[model samples]
Target: MSLTADPPSGAVPATGGTLTHNLVNSGAEKVVFKVRSSNNNEYRVKPVFGFVEPSGTTSLEITRLAGPAKEDKIVVQFAPSPADAPSASSAFNAVQPTGNVTIPISAT
Candidate 1:
């Protein structure tokens, strides 16, 4: 039940670039998670799919746009299934226990 993003420093060029992240399921049960950009005007998420098995790993790619003349913060939210949840799909139904991470984009 751990998540990490590459360029872990969370720094992206203002001119836009590709951001990659990885999620790992450390628990003994399957897990499902969803990803979305906090600011769609500034960033786009590709292949917005979520499904990861126990001890499984998945990655997501985000395309950032160049705009907003200042340092913009975009949060890539990840909501995973709870431990008691039957499965990834059920987790969404339960709608509890989730996590998120932020990315910093410098419009240089």
Candidate 2:
């Protein structure tokens, strides 16, 4: 499994920029994926939690809630089922046998 985001980190424009992230699951079993911003007040993530079928792919979008911000961090994590209990809250809170990825965002 892997997670990636475009424009990893940079200054935020006056109109803000849309962050596009992709998550890929190559395992044979289903897995759960989650996305969260270190500072929710500054950044927003949609469909915070969802499932990724085996050999499937998913995408997420993060948008700046306010006009601009100094910096922020977005986390994308995945946890395989059975071994790691599932949760509706966050993947960070769950046991990540599959590890995670963090992307940084900053403002100009």
Candidate 3:
């Protein structure tokens, strides 16, 4: 059971202003995904936290607020969810993530 992101390039074009990436849960059980940005002050991530059922897709939208680019990156972390998981924040606090996927940002 694992999670993967599209746009293998992991490209967050700063000039484009905003970009969307889909997080797919390939696991058989429900999984919770937490999306985070290295520079939270400069970028806003929609639904920073969420859940994806087995074989489901969750879209992660990131919008860059007018700021010069640095060594910023978007990180996606995941952990299995309980049958009766309460909320994204709680579920995340309960289990340790199996892995992480990082997307690098670039200004072009």
Cα RMSD for candidates in order: 3.8, 3.6, 1.8
Question: Model 3 over residues 1-108: C-alpha lDDT tens digits?
Answer: 888888643544555488888888888988887888888887888888789889998888888876664667899888898777779878887889888988877654
Query: Over the stretch 1-108, how does candidate 1's per-residue lDDT look in tens digits?
Result: 555444543556777887776666666655556565656787776545466667777776777778755565545445555667655555655665366556565555
On lDDT, the candidate that comes out on top is 3
After superposing candidate 3, which stretches have Cα over 4 Å from the reference?
10-16
Error of 1 at 50 (Å): 0.5
Candidate no. 1 TM-score: 0.64
- Can you give the lDDT of residue 80 in candidate 2? 68
RMSD of 1: 3.8
Question: What lDDT is obtained when candidate 1 is compared to the true structure?
Answer: 0.61
lDDT of 1 at 101: 55
What's the TM-score of every candidate structure?
0.64, 0.68, 0.87
Residues 35-81, model 2: lDDT tens digits: 76787776777768876667777777777755654767788777765
Q: Which stretches of candidate 2 lie over 4 Å from their true place?
A: 1-14, 82-98
TM-score (C-alpha) between model 2 and the true structure? 0.68
**lDDT of predicted model 2:** 0.66
